[model samples]
Target: MKSLIVVDCQYDFIDGTLACENAENAVNSIIKYINSNDIKVHYSKDWHSIHNGSFKDNGGVWPVHCVQGERGARLHEDFYKHVEKDVKRPKEDNVFYKGIDDEVEEYSAYNAENSQKLSLKDALEDEVIVAGIASEYCVRETVLELLEAGHMVEILKDGLGYVDSEDHLKNLQDLMERGVRII
Candidate 1:
């Protein structure tokens, strides 16, 4: 069995505080991919506190986004509409969250845990396919971490969006060079 991990498709990274080009566009691609029956789907996000080093309010480069209990911290509406209610899709009861700390930039999905306190590493198989917003950030880190965990990892290219266009291309190339498959 293969796992499909969707990294940080939150409102802040989509059309809110840290919005980037094409992040919203990749939602449909992710939706389409998750609609398939062969894989287990998981979601991750930046569930930040009020004060963080990654927030401009502190000393980080990014604007304050994905704050707890805020609408901007939530997932895109369409993502839910497309996959949340379907009985046929993988049973998606876990939403892994990271960056709960105010000072760390915990980008990997491995840093996350669900409502039941289950780690993504425990749920995953030997193979994983990753897709999500900010190709140069969370998505990239999650894939790299998966590789470190000894999983055969693949990236869903069409299902990715980038914060930096040039870095996005470079990161994709770097991942490929490291033997991470692109699909």
Candidate 2:
């Protein structure tokens, strides 16, 4: 079965505190692609707690963002609208949340679980088309995890962003070397 793994395209990753470079530009294309596809769509949220080491100020690597119930944690409005409208099918229960733990950080959506405790690896059958913010971060981590789980992952190149250009290219190279296909 085909699945579209949409990583954190939330406000915090796009235009909020931890915004990625050019992340905003991918919105329309992502929306069009999701609405036009017939396969299952998986949306991942970086639902965090109020305090965590994931924030630089707290001694973690990243800035503070995506706290649960916060505005920054919400998905980009337009992209989320597509999820709300399209993820209603009985077989379409793929919206998962990650990065919620205050102690250990989980960048991959596969690390998160649905209400039923199903991870993406459990929910997905075969192939996945990836799209989301920060190509060098959450999106990259999720794709690597999916690939390790034996899923065929094809990243939508134009639909991703990165905080650092050089690291972005390096990460893409790493994915390609690991048999991930870029579209």
* Highest-scoring model, lDDT: 1
Candidate 2 per-residue lDDT, tens place, 66-135, comes to 9888999987888645544546322325668787678898888877776676776777759998888889
The total number of steric clashes, by the backbone 3 Å criterion, in model 1 comes to 0
- Model 2 gets an lDDT of 0.80
All candidates: TM-score: 0.93, 0.90
Question: Can you write out model 1's per-residue Cα lDDT over 1-183, one digit (the tens) per residue?
Answer: 788888888888888878887887898888887776477778887888888888777888888888987998887777667785454232346678788877678888876888778888887889899999889988888988899989999999988988888999999999999999999
CA RMSD of all predictions: 1.9, 2.4
Residue 1 in model 2: shift from native, Å? Answer: 3.5
Every candidate's lDDT: 0.83, 0.80
Candidate of highest TM-score: 1
Model 2 lDDT, residue 38, Cα: 77
Report the C-alpha displacement of residue 13, candidate 2, in angstroms.
Answer: 0.6
Candidate 1 segments whose C-alpha is farther than 4 A from its true place: 84-92
